[model samples]
Structure formats: structure tokens, C-alpha cells
Target: MNLNQLKYFLAIVKTGSFSNAADDMYISQSSMSKQIKALETELGVDLFKREHSKVYLTEIGAEFAKYAEMTIKQHNDMLLYLDEFATKKSNTIRFGSIPVVSSYGISAQIAQFTTNYKPDVNVVIDMHETNQQEVMKELFDGAIDIALIRTDYLDEVDVFDCIPYKKDIFVLVCNQNHPLSTKEAVSLNDLIKYPLSLLDTSSVIYTIVMKAFERHGIEKKTKCLTTRHKILMEILQTAPNISLLPLSLVDLTLFPHLCTVPLVEELTSDVALIKLKKRRLNKITKDFWIYWQKYFQMQ
Candidate 1:
């Protein structure tokens, strides 16, 4: 019935065990169990089925969990709103971005947004590893106001509204001394000559690249498949390998020894600003969304 009880319930569900949840919440197992028992008594339902070594949420518990999560989120948001009112500041806009968007130009845009909005508003940005599903979960949980993610990953079940912010073209990046560095445009066939180092298939850029190869019937193999951008860049620097990256992510200024060329076969991904469809935007978040739209339009 209380926020603490709800927290314990959610923790137990997430960690899948009372003891583990207790450890994560920095509480004793007995206290955690007592809280859950009290919660079950208040709700008049057995929330969990305790077995030998594991705990499973009862059917009713699973149904109650949805409401419990919403209640806790609303409670936290109310506290934040009151705190902002007391401080005489506009509401904070919590923004989330996948690594690709964060690296593209979101940081600079955020800086400009803060500068323009001044002391009236606060903007907080969290960079996430590229996982659209995780990002959508955070959005739904009210952890972030908006997310910058690739549109290709958006699914029907996400139930979020999105505005296309930018299109990032896939480019072949390599050491300046590499053979294809000076080429005006390289095809999938031309790229076969060099060993490829690619971001893992989970990345939208990788998907686009692979689909392009498949569409063109170009059979290719990668010398390296990594999830880390820095590691991929390191491989490019040390070896005569080419990697596909979004044009915006290829900062020649930072990697002066490397160069990027357009793919003869056009391949690109759309990055969008996504938010829960039913969530209302506050003044700060609204202003930020508008600013981002204008900024990208100008670009």
C-alpha cells in the first residue's frame, strides 16, 4: 500500500528473489519479506508463490504490478514537480539518447538548448548503449522525457510517437592510406577487396550495411564484429580494414588519419525523437523538442 512496499514488490519481481532484492535494496531479507507480506495482506491477495529457491509472481500479482509501477512513478514525478516549484525553476527535461545519436550532434544541440533556455529550465542527457527496447522501457517508465533513436527499431508495440530528426547515411571509413580512401564512391563489390570491421549486427548501421550487401548479392565476411565504436575505430587505425558507420558519427577532425566515402549503393538510417504518445510535454521539454526540430531543419 505504501511506496516502500511497492518498491520492495517491484524489486522482488525484477531480481526474481526476495533475498536478492533485499540485497539490492540494502535491506535485510526478513524485513523485505515482512514488507511483502504486509503488502499482500493490504491487497488481500498472495502476491508471490514461494517455491524451494525461487519466487514467482502469482497471476494476480502480475496484474497488480502494472498498477504498482504506475503509482510509484506518479509519486516520484509529483515529488519532482513539487521540488521544482519550491526551487522556483522550470521542470527538468530528462533526455535519453542511443550512442549513435549522442555522438552525431545531440550534445552540441543540448548545449545550445540549455544556453537558450537559461536558468528557467534544466536539461539532463543520459547516453545509452544501442538498444531500442531498453530505451522504450525507460521512456514508458517515465525515466526520460524523450529519446533519440533509430526509426528502424521502432515497433508497433512501442506505441510511441516519433518525429524524424535526421537521416544518417552509411559511409565506408578507413585509414587515409587505404586503397578506397580516395574513391569518389565505393560499391559493395569494391569494399570486398578490403577486410571489414563492423559494428555488431544489433546496430542499425550494421543492419543497413548487411541488407545492402544482401540486396546487391555481394557475399562478404567481416574480420571483426564489435559493439564498441572506439574499438572499431582502433581496428581501422591498426589494420587495412574498412568499417561502415553513420556519416555523422565519422568525425574526421577527431580521427584525422581516417577518411569516409559515400557508398555507391545508398544506405541510410533515420534517427527520430521519440516519446510516449499519451505523455504530455512540459514547457521545457516542449521548447527542447521545438529547438531540436529547428536545428535539424537548418542543418
Candidate 2:
């Protein structure tokens, strides 16, 4: 019913006991019990079922937990705003960028944000390893105010506004010693001739590269190597392996020995900035977006 009640319920569910929840929340067990009781009374249903001295959320309890989580997140964000920027002149915004986008000028944009809009706005950039779908989860859950992600990977959240960040490219990379490495570009013939070391095709890079390969009529041929991320530099560092990777994966610092050239064919990927529909983007997110645009222009 209230933020306190939701907090109590979540704590109980997490700690699995009233006494433990009270300890975690630093409240008296009786007070914790009263809050739970009041919540259960208001809902007119049992939220937790105790069995063998263990407590678990009942069917409705499980469902209400979701609502409680959303409510608590909203309340907490409000509290943060009140304490940090009571007058609302300057506000802090939190946002996220997948590692790939961060390399593509997202961080630089955020850094330069205050150069133009001085005072009252703080931007916090959180690095997350989420793909497009998980990016939606982070945004919708209010964990991040906005996000920079790959466009092709956007989840089914139709309400969010997506701004084009840049025209990024995905390329196939391998050791220079690789047989196909000497070729100016890859072809189905070139790919078929070699065993492929690849990242999980379900990953963002794979999806982007594979879709292009499919359109070009290249059959998917993979060899033994597989990884979640870092497939590019990993394969390159090792010998006789091939991987699909974003062009930026060849950063001099990250992959000191890596050399990048365009693949035989054109494979394009886009970076995008997205936010929840009709949501008020706090100063932080907006500043990041504005600077991101400028960064892209300079590039």
C-alpha cells in the first residue's frame, strides 16, 4: 500500500523470515509484522505461506511483488530527487551504455556535456553488459533513465523514442596468419574454406553480422570456438580463428595487436539512444544525449 509496506514485503520475501527481514531493515520484528499484516489486510489475501517455518510468496503474493518493486523504485527515485535537487534547478540523471556503444563516443559525449550546459545537471553513466532486450528491461524498470544501444536489437517496447547515434559497422576479424585473413574481403567461398571460430550467434555482434551474411547468401559455418563476448580479440589473439566483431573492437589499447579491415561485404550496424515513452528525461540523460549528438557530429 505504501513504500514502507512494499519495502517490508520485499525484505521478508528476500530474507525468507519476518525476524530476518526486520534485522535487515533495521526495524523491530513487531513493526515488520504489523506492516505485513496491514498489507495483507488491505489486499485481503495472504502474501506469504509459511511451511516448515519457511515463508514464501503465495500466488497473489508473487504477483504483488512485481507491483511493489515498481512502486518502491518510483518512490525511491522521487526521494533521490527531493534530497539532491529540491529546487529542481539542477538535476542528476542516470543512464547506461552497453560496452560496445561506450567505445563509440558515448562516454566522450557525456564528458563534454557540462562544457555547454553548466550548473545544476549531473550525468552518471553506468556501464552494463546488456543486449538490446535487457536494455529495455533496465530502462522500463527505471534502473536507467535512458540508454545507448544497437538499433537492430531494440526490444518490443514501442513507446520508447529511439534516436540514431551513428552508423556503426560489424566486420569479420581473424589473425593475419589466417588463410582467409590475406584476402581483401570475405566471401562465402572464403568463409567455407576455413573453420570459423565465432561468438555465440545469438549475441549482438553475431546477430548483426549473420543477418548481413544471410542477405548475401552466405551459409552459417562455425568452427569449434565459442564465447559470449570478446570473441573478436580473443580469436585474433589466438591463431587460425575467425570472429564477427564491431570495428571498434580493434581499439589500440584493448587489442594492441589487432588490425581491422572491412569485411568482403558491407555489414552495417547502427547505434541508438532510447528512452521510455513520454517519460521526463532528467537533466543527466538529456545532457548525455545532447553531447552524444555533438560527439557524433565531430566524428
Q: Please, what is the TM-score per model?
A: 0.67, 0.63
Put down candidate 1 lDDT per residue, 1-299, tens digits, no spaces: 78888988998998899998887676899999999998889889999999998999999999999999888767756755664564333456767767765576667777777776768445554445555545655675566778988886566636776778778788889999998989999888998778888888767767778888889988888889987677788778768999988888877777778888888887889988887766666667777778877776887
Question: Candidate 2: deviation at residue 140, Å?
Answer: 0.9
Model 1 earns a TM-score of: 0.67
> Lowest summed lDDT over 10 consecutive residues: which window, candidate 2?
83-92
| lDDT scores in order | 0.78, 0.67
Residue 148's C-alpha lDDT in candidate 2?
Answer: 75
lDDT of 2: 0.67
Q: Using TM-score as the measure, which candidate wins?
A: 1
Q: In model 2, which regions exceed 4 Å deviation?
A: 1-90, 119-129, 213-231, 252-257, 293-299
Candidate 2 lDDT, tens digit per residue, 7-50? 88997987799988887677899999898999899989999998
Task: For candidate 1, give the lDDT.
Answer: 0.78
Residue 163, model 1, lDDT: 74
Best by lDDT: 1
